[model samples]
Target: MKLEKSIIGMVHVQALPGTPNNKHSIEEICEIAVQEAKTYEEAGLDAIMIENMHDVPYLKGAVGPEITASMAVVARAIREVVNLPLGIQILAGANKEALAVAKAANFQFIRAEGFVFGHVADEGYIDSCAGELLRYRKVIGAEDVKIFTDIKKKHSSHALTADVDIDETAKAAEFFLSDGLIVTGASTGKAVYLHELKSLKDKVQIPVLIGSGITAENLEEYWNYASGFIVGSHFKENGFWKNPISKDRLKVFMEKVKQLKK
Candidate 1:
C-alpha cells in the first residue's frame, strides 16, 4: 500500500500444471520464476508481481484448488529469493483465491480485477467482489495484503456501465475501500490514455497505478500522473509478456524511470 512511483516488474509465471501451456514441471516453473524475480531485484526494480498470465482460457473465478496451490508454490519460491515486495494475482477475477495465495506465500499485495462494477470478460461475466474479498482477507488475517484493483480493466466489455464515466467509477472503488486503483488500456500491453490517467489522478485520493504499456518512450509522459507502474510487456523480449525477461530492455526502461524520478 506504500508504493511510491516506483518501477514494479512483472514475473509472469509460465502456464501452471493442468493448464494448456504446461510444458515445464512445477519445479521447472518455480525455478524460472525465482530467477526472473532475482533478475528484477538485481536490476534495481522496486518490486515484482507474479501472475499466472500464461494460463489462458481462464475460468471466471475459483479456478480449482490446483491453480491456487500451484500459485502458492511459485510465489513461495520467489519470496525466498528476493527481498523486493512481492505481489500475486489470479487470472479472471479470482480475488479471494489470490488473497489466499498471498497469505500462503507471504506476499505483500494482489492485483485484483472486478473489484467494482460488473463486466463481460472473455471467460464470462465478472461481478464486484470487493465485499466478499475484503471480508475473506480479514478472516485470513491478511489485512496487510494490499489490494490494487483494476478499473476499466483491459480485455473486457464495459458497455454494461456505459452511463457511468471513469471518474464516477473510480469514486465507487474508493468508497468500497480499495487499497489502490489500477488504470489500464483496452488490452494487455496497451498503453493507457494519458488524459484518462490525468483525470483520475486529479480526482482520486488513493494511489493510481498504470497497469500496462509503459515503455521508455512514454515513461516521462505518464510519470507526472501515475503513482506506480505495473509493467510486464515492456520488460519482456520484444515487449511481449510471455517472452523471457530482457535485461537489455529492462535496463533502458529503468534508466528512463531513474531520470524521470530526478
Candidate 2:
C-alpha cells in the first residue's frame, strides 16, 4: 500500500498466551483488538497495524508456534471488521514470524526490526536479518507484504555502529532492499529529532516513517517530512500503552490531522 502522508494507527493487541504477562484469554484479546481497529478506521486513520507489544519480556529473534498462532487469529479477526490497509509486527526481531502472520492474515505490510546492523536491545544482541528475512519472504510468497525496517531503532543501543550516521544506515537498509524505513526516538513514546528526519529525507529515496511520539500537538513539525506516522501511546488512555484506546483522544488527534491535510 502507498503510505504517502499516511497515519497508521496501532492496535496493540493485549498480552496473549505463553507470555510472562499474558492476562487476557485469546478470545478477549481479539475482541479488544478489533474494537481499537474499528475506532482507528472510524477516526479516519489511513491504515492499521496489529502488534504484539503487550507481550512483555518479549522473546528474542524467534517466537514459539503458539505466539505465532495466536497473532494470526488476532490479526485475522481484526481484518474481518476493519477494511483499512492492515499490517503486523511481532516484537523483538521476530520478522519471519511476522511475515508469516501477515501473509496468512492478508496484511499489506510489516514493521520489521533488526533488518540491518546489529544492536544490543533489551532482549539481547540482534543480528542483521536482511539476507535471511528476504529469502524467507520470497519462499513464503509474501513478496507483496512490504517490510518497513527500523534504523537505529528505539529502546536499543547502536554502539556497534556508532560511527555510522543515520544517513549511512538509511542507505544500507535501502541497499538491503527495504520497502521503507522507520525512524524513532531513544525509546518508545519519545520524540524523534527533526534535523535527523530532514537529513534522511534528502538521503533516501524510499519512504521514511516516524514511528513514535506523534500526537495532535506536535505532528505539524514532522508532517512534511514523514511518509507516514505509526502512532500508539498518544491515542491511549492518559497516553499510556497498557490502557485501552481512548476514542475521545483519537477524535481530537484526527481532527487536527484533517486540518493539516487541508
Candidate 3:
C-alpha cells in the first residue's frame, strides 16, 4: 500500500466465462495474465493489478460467482510468479467482490469505484458504497488490502454530483477513509488535466494517484503531483488496452521512471 511514486502495471485479464466475449477458457486467460505479470515485473513495475477489463459489456452491479471464481484462479496464479505487490479490481462497482478476491489471493490493494458520490457509468448508476464497502472489508478482515478509489472517474457521467468539483470529491473520499484517490480524464487512456492534479495536491492527506493517461513522454509533467501512477494502455501494444503488453514499451517507460527516481 506504500505507493509513493510507484508504477503499478495493469494486467487486463481476458474475457471470462458467461460473459458475451468469453472465447478463451479460464486456463487460457490465466496463462496470458501470468505472462503479462512476469513481463511487468521484469520491466521493473513497483506493483501489478489484475482487472477484468476485457469482460466487456460489463455487468451493471456485482458480477456472478463464476467471474469471481475465475478472477481468484487468475490472481492466485499470477501471485505465485511475481514478487511485487498485487491487486485486483472487479469491474462495474464490484468493490466488495474485489476485496474478497484480493484477500484470497494475498493481493495488496484494489481499485474501487463509487467509493463516494453517485455516477452514471456505462454499466449504469453506481451508487456511493463507502459505508457498505468498508463494512464488508471489516467483516471479511481485509483491512490490510488497500482500496484506491476513483474520483471523477473515467467512462462515466458525474451529472448526479455536478455541483461537486474534483477537489471536493477528493476531500469526501479522504473523509470516507479511502486508502488513496485516483484522478483520471474523461475516458480511459485519456490524460488527466494537469491543473486538476495541481489543484488536488493540497486538498487531501491521502495519496493522490494518476489512474489514467500517463505516458513516458509526459511522465515528467505529472511526476511531482502524484504519489503513484497506474498505467495500462500506454504499456500495451500501440498504446491500446485490448492489445497485449509490449515488453519494449514497458521497459522504456520504466527506464524513464528509474531515471526520475534516481
Candidate 4:
C-alpha cells in the first residue's frame, strides 16, 4: 500500500523495573504508555508505534508471558483513546508475539526487525523470519495487519549479509511480501543516511519509512524520499532515547512536518 508523507510518533513505553532491569512496575509502565499515547495523539501525529525499548538486555526469542501480557494490556488501552493507526513492536524479533498482540488489540501493523535478512544483533544472531512470521499471521488470520520490515536494521551487525547491498536487500523484502520497508541507522536513535533512503526508494515499490533519528531540522530533507518517519530520540529530553518524551519537542517537530506536508 502507498504511504503518505506523514509523521509517525514513537512511544517507547518504559518497562517494569526490577524484574531483571530497572525499578518500574508493569502498572507504572502502562500508565506512562497511556499518557504518552494520548500526548502523541493530541500532538496530531499520523500514527503511533508502541515498543519495549526500555526492556533492554532484551531476550533473544520469546520474552516471558509477563512482558507480552503487560505490553498487550497497555497497547489495548492506548488503542481505546487513540483513533490514529496503532502498531506494535517487541524487541529481538518476536514477530509472532507482536502479530498476536496486534491481532488481539486490533492494531494496524507491526515493526519487525530481522524480518527478511539474517543479522547479528546486540542480543545475538537474528535469523530471517519472513516465512514463519507470514505463516503465523495467516494461521492467526491477521493478514490485514501490515509487516514493516527493517532493511539494514539498526543496532545489529549485518556484515554476515554483506553480499546483499541495501537496494537488493530491500528488493528481496518486497519480493518476500513485506508490506513496508524501514531504513534505519547503525544503532537505535541514530539517523539514517539520505543517500541510502534514496537508493531504497528508487528500488522498492512499497512504502519506505525512516525508522530512526528524525528531527525537526532534517525532516524536510527526508520528506522528499521518505513516505513516513518513525521519530523517537529527538522527541525526548536532551535528544536522548532513554529520557522521557518531551511534549514541547513533539509540538515543534510536528509543526515542521506539517509545514513540509503543506
Clash number for each model: 0, 0, 0, 3
The 10-residue segment of model 4 with minimum total lDDT is 15-24
Task: Give the winner by TM-score: 2 or 4.
Answer: 2
* Weakest lDDT window of 10 consecutive positions for candidate 3: 52-61
Arranged by lDDT, best first: 2, 3, 1, 4
- Predict model 3's lDDT versus the native: 0.93
All candidates: CA RMSD (Å): 0.8, 0.7, 0.7, 1.4
Candidate 1 lDDT, tens digit per residue, 1-262? Answer: 4778978999989999899988999999999999999999999999999989999979897688998999999999999889989898999788888999999888999999899999889998999999999999999999999999998889999999989888999999999999899999999899999889889977879999999888889888899898889889999898888899999998998888888878
Per-residue CA lDDT of model 4 for 62-166, tens digit only, reads 777877787798899899888999998988788888999999999999999887879988889999999999999999999999999998888888899899999
Poorly placed runs, candidate 1 (over 4 Å): none
After superposition, the stretches of candidate 2 with alpha carbons farther than 4 Å from their true spots are none
User: Against the correct fold, how does model 1 do in TM-score?
Assistant: 0.98
Per-residue alpha-carbon lDDT of model 3 for 127-161, expressed as tens digits?
99999999999999998999999999999998889
Candidate 2 lDDT, 133-252, residue by residue in tens: 999999999999999999999999999999999999999999999999999999889989999999999898999999999988999999999999999999999999878889999999
Q: Which residue pairs clash in candidate 4?
A: 17-23, 17-24, 18-22
Instruction: Report how far residue 205 has shifted in candidate 1, in Å.
Output: 0.9
lDDT of all predictions: 0.90, 0.94, 0.93, 0.86
